[model samples]
Target: MLNIRLASSMVSGVAGELLAAEAQTHHLRSTCSTSVSTLSSLESELESLLSKTHAIDGVTNQISSLALDTRILSLNATIEAAHAGEAGAGFAVVANAVRDLSRETAKATSTIFDHLQAVLSAVDRVQKVHEQLREQMLELDRESGVLAVRVKEQGEIVSTAVRFVDEAIDAATTPCAQAQNAPPASDTYALAPADDDYALAPADDDYGLAPVGDDYGLAPVDDDYGLAPVDEDDPYALASDEADEPPDSESMDDPYALEAV
Candidate 1:
């Protein structure tokens, strides 16, 4: 019985019980540390994804702004075209409106394109991270790799598109100096020649106005604004007094009177 009692005391001793409890506590602490580390890593990945989403949103806003500017340019083009008239001659004369609108639109587009290029570059780098992390996720295998590849290629494509747009803006900005501010042309189609010592003679005693200058055939003009002839006593006297007067409707084409022949 004393041996049995001694054996029980040894088994239930403070040293052994305490040692076992301490080992269990250490194990729990290790497990908790691993859990904390995993959670921190997951939090970091989530933050990266959030940052990427925000970047995409910013780029989308930029694109939307560019589109709005382009729409304004389009409307301006249509409005200016409607007003250009026959005098515009060709597209060159009207090119100012087009060039101005295009330039403003190009400015907006270039800004968007530049920002987009930056975004694509950043995304490209992040895409690498997205791939490597995705591979280590311990989830789906083939789908994750394929998705990563597609995302990376899409970023590259977006970069190319942005570069193309920027180039287009630069090309459109080329200016022509002479086209915008050219002087109006000299008149080519002047009417009649000039004369000296021409006098406008008096008409009837009652009417002071006389038609004078050539055989446009005059009459005793009575009204302030000219009407036409009444019954004339003689056509010869009318012709002499008609000098300086515009040709009448009847003889307007007579080359001899105009000295054209």
Candidate 2:
């Protein structure tokens, strides 16, 4: 039977340790999943970016070469038309017009190509930046979530500890209050506000409170044992009857017994 009890205790301890370790592992896995997803997305984006960049370079170069060739051909045609005699005179103007048109078109194409390349470069840079920012955002969000979970867990643990401390304190103080040997928790409890205008009575004898004499000029006390306002003429004070008294009980019966009759 002893061995069984020991085995059960060991098993419970091991199970608790395993459960804690598993929770830690689960949290780690959650972080890893976010990281892995980010990395995967980044890798795929980079691959697409590399392919697009290669294609853009090749297409831009080819278009540039084509424009250059067209300009050269237009120039040669004008030269040939100029070398011919009067019979080619009419053709010469046409050829010159063709050359001018070619130059204009080539300039337009080159300008367009430059602007297009610039736009493409800008887009690529922006996309790369966006991808990086997205990865960072994902990482931050995941981290924040993990931190929030940890904070919540800590708060719960702290709340549980406080509750346990309160219960234990209440249990330890039970005996004291029962035998009237010490002040009760109720004494420590804040006095409730009276619904009526009448003053609230102090704790009574049943609550282990002492009897008040005529000098019981009740004063307001706070949780920190600080005094608030009070009426000096008020008949209620906290004086007890156990203190020194005169020989005859009837002599002290008057509310103003101590005062000159």
Q: Which one wins on lDDT?
A: 2
The runs of at least 3 residues in candidate 2 whose Cα sits more than 4 Å from the true structure, single-residue gaps closed, are 1-66, 169-261
For candidate 2, the TM-score is 0.41
lDDT of each: 0.51, 0.57
Which tens-of-lDDT digit does each residue in 84-189 have in candidate 2?
8777777778777766766676676677667767766776776678678766766776775676566556656655655555566567668767878745456433
- Backbone steric clashes in candidate 1, count: 8
Candidate 2, position 216, lDDT: 40
TM-score of 1: 0.29
Clashing pairs in 1: 212-242, 212-243, 212-244, 212-245, 213-242, 213-243, 213-244, 214-243
Candidate 2: worst-modelled 10 consecutive residues by lDDT: 223-232
**CA displacement after TM-score superposition, residue 35 of candidate 2 (Å):** 14
